[model samples]
Target: MPENRISRAKLTTDIVLAGVFGLMSLPFALMGNWADLVAMALFVSALAVRRLAPAWSLGIAWCAATVQMAALRDLQFYDFAVLGVLYSTAAHGGRLVKWLGLVSAGVGALIATVYLQVLMPIFGDTSGLTPENLIAAAFILVASLALLVLAWTAGLLARSVREGREVRRREEVANRERALVEYRYTVEQERNRIARDMHDVVAHSLAVVIAQADGARFAAKTRPDAASEALQTISGVARGALGDVRVLLAELRHREGGAPQPVLDDLGELIEGVVAAGLDVRRVETGEPCELGTGHQIAVYRIVQEALTNALRHGDPGAPVEVRFDWTPTGVSLMIANRLADAAGGPGTTATGATATGPTGARHGITGMRERAQLVGGTLSAEPGGDGVFRVVASIPAQPRSTA
Candidate 1:
């Protein structure tokens, strides 16, 4: 509900409570008991502001009680409004007012005992301090104190329940915000991984198909056998690209992980495929291979795949591409280099092995390779060497396979 409406509703309820008590005390005004009627009016006013202004309500109740004691008026039904004021002090009052309510409960009980039992009997009955009357007065004092203190305690219990509910609600909202942040982070990581896979599969295959298609078109009239071989390579590369794309699509449809990915063991087939498309590749390995986790292996495979694809698309067709792997006890380092085509052999080439407008236009291939290396706690750099050769180098640390 709107705040103003809620406030108005609370005011209405308090008014109804005050009206009911005022009607019950109407006999005081009808019987010409003016002092009692004035005390009742103060108590009714206190009840009306009990929730809306608890401190004011408490002050007003004290005034009414003082007037009744001063006038020596007997107890009336409207006096019960004191308990409601005490309750509101704890339930709605600020810290200072809440403690004051407790003090009022104790002090008001003591005052009532003195006024009713000690003073009233001396004035009305001319009674001396008898033992039996003293015992009865002591019992009334304890009962009156308990009643006032119980009302204040009930209000305190209500305050505790309300505070507890507010604490739980705040905790629930914080948990939801934390969950949303974690979910977004997971989704972004997954998207980057998928983008890397798509680039590796599509870019590499298309480069091979373009190379074989060009060669087939040129040699179709002169050498039919060479043309037939080129067609076969193109067909195989296209089919493999199609299968990889389908697997990626399937992974998107179902979130249960992806198909088996290429690893270090698959490097031979990768090199052979490019060689069939008419680029000479020389691969050399040194030292012993270290074990690596599945995620690290994927990073390595994609980095090498993207590097080779960049070379096949931008390197000189007549020159050989050199690939080397140096393995140590801790990690493996890779280097792939190829002579740049005549058009790319310029001083204006950027550090990413590309010109202002190099092959694979936006250079997402190099950026993706760098991101993949970083994901596996590795590093990569691609730049043109002083000898007019474009080199892609990467270093990856070994990690234990996960059992889960």
Candidate 2:
């Protein structure tokens, strides 16, 4: 609809311009110069289609000049329309027409010089080709050519400016599309990180709470004090889980509202919570600890949390879990092992009766852990052994802190 409106407007503008040119040439029609009137009418018609059909406009202009030369008439005011036709050919015409406009400018200038200087005087007077007349003719040809070429050059400049604007507009659109794609990619990555954090926090906490609650229920009548301690552990674990959930929700609501994440120092509290849930955990550290960047630390912390959570959920209740960390100058290696709940294999279980941690088994939790390890330039593996034990081993390389 808008395109239609613009086209109508351009057509209206061309009609008005043609009308004005015709009105200006009305004097020739009134003066009874029939040939001049005919040429003016043709030139006016060319002006009407100057932009809409530049090739046709150029043709009409040549016909007007031919009629005027055949009558041996002097250049009239409406003859200026030839300049407009040439300009339109360069500005609005296709490749062939644009070059043709230049050729027409040169040839028309030469022809006009000959018709006015030689042919007109031959028919109207007895003047011969004197040196002064020849020199004047040369000046006239140069001037006419310069004027026509200048008009064409102006049209070419306009074309260049329009094309440049079009190029800039396309570049802006491409930049916007690129930025939108990057934004979506960043958003997806952040969402995955949040999901991993939520799983680590909620899953571990619920597992501990469930164990404590079950123990409390079984020991309530036999040992009231033991039941009370179990209830306390459950309460603490639940409250901590609630707080972590609130923080995660805050981060969801406001991108920059994330709380400080757990680091290596917080592992002690993690282990203590699991122990209070009635699982025995043994920790062994070998070699000196090395510094790790924030991202690497987060990866290490989440991997350990997930591994311990899996053991608490799937391992034998009476068996002790072992966590070993071997640190070197470059990085740390971690191994966690626990006895299986059942010694005989069954559905959803390995040969050792431990829950399968492969893609088809405990997929989500193990996959999350593996992704975290890889994010920090590390590797992780989880499998159940023939000895009825499930093991998780990871090697994480230290990374340098990023500068601001």
Candidate 3:
């Protein structure tokens, strides 16, 4: 019923106040009579326990009230302790105890009126109570009931305010926790997006550079001019890769673009660059040109780029690679294929021809390609076929035609 935690300092202060109230009431009880002395003692005891045990405080105040009635005395100053106990019962006690405080106020008023106005004087000096005495008794009953009920109501109101504040504090804490979880989920999605981007850029560039390095190595003795060209191609590919890596790093710092995203229009230069590195890449096109959103164009470009890059990395260097595009009103279809291994033996090496090799620990190429396709409302599959060949097929759906 009391506050949940009371510091040692606060306990000491309350004890001192209780002692002072008792000492102040001591003289009035001594001068009035033995019965007043007993009533004051019980009322002061109720004050001492009011906060620590509010229901018990109320019970003790009722005992003091009964003692005052039996003593047949006028109300003493110490009887004010009943108001303090009534306040505590509502402020600190449970529901049952709070109702008991209100009941005590009504019942105590009735008992005190009858004893003081009618019984006390008839036994002592008055032969009987007059009409004026009865009226005074009614006034005393109303006044005492008002003060006691006011004290209890004040306690109930204070309790309501404290409970409201506690509820608001808990809601604020829950909101903060929900916001933190959403923030973490958003950060995780962004990180996965960046990882896919890095894989596409770095893997495609490495595949081109490796093919060029192989060309330069195999051509150095017999064809000096061819070797020089291969070196030039390698240099260009490396520079592009470096620039792309710089752009990705800048993205980590939340900077705007430092490199342009590849689009379908860039496919020609992309195919030409691969062919220059010694892979025989043939291009085929059908149907009329169609407009596409930037996101769809990027997906188309990257799918072709990654397919060709895989042919250079994992297919025979002298193998013929074919890329075809079929555009319709609804969507575009794409296919890319290359020999998986040289006719002579092993992967990437041709019979009577040279081999191209590069770093080979990546498996995210297909995943990155599939993610790109999905972003454009499309599908893609890359697989090896029965004739020692690898193939890629992709279907990219188009958006509604824009008139603007």
- C-alpha lDDT values of all predictions: 0.85, 0.85, 0.79
Model 1 Cα lDDT, one tens digit per residue, 179-288: 98888787777766776798789999998999999999999999999999999999999999999988887876665565998888898899999999898999999999
Compare the candidates by TM-score and give the number of the best one: 2
Error of 1 at 172 (Å): 1.5
List the candidate 3 regions with Cα displacement exceeding 4 Å. Answer: 1-92, 98-130, 255-272, 280-305, 320-337, 342-362, 371-380, 386-389, 393-404
| Cα lDDT tens digits for candidate 2, 1-404 | 01112276787798799989899888865575788888989999999888878888899999999998998888778888888888988888889889999999999999999987888877876576667767878999999999999999989888899889999999999999999999888778887888889989988999899898999999999999999999988888899899999888888876555589888888898899889888899999999898888888888888888888878888888999999999998899999998878745567675433366543334678889899999889999987887888888999997776686
| 1-404: candidate 3 lDDT, tens digit per residue | 45335577766765677789989989888889888888888888888777777877888888887777766778888988887888888877878888888888788778777888888869757768889888999998898778888988998888788789889999999999999888777766656666767777787788788777877898899999999988888899899889888887777666234457777879999999888877899999999767777778888888888888778777767769999999998889999988865544566543212245432322467768888898789999876665767778999997754467
TM-score of 3: 0.73
**C-alpha RMSD for every candidate:** 3.3, 3.4, 5.5
Count of clashing residue pairs in every prediction = 0, 0, 0
Q: What pairs collide in candidate 3?
A: none
TM-score ranking from best candidate downward:
2, 1, 3
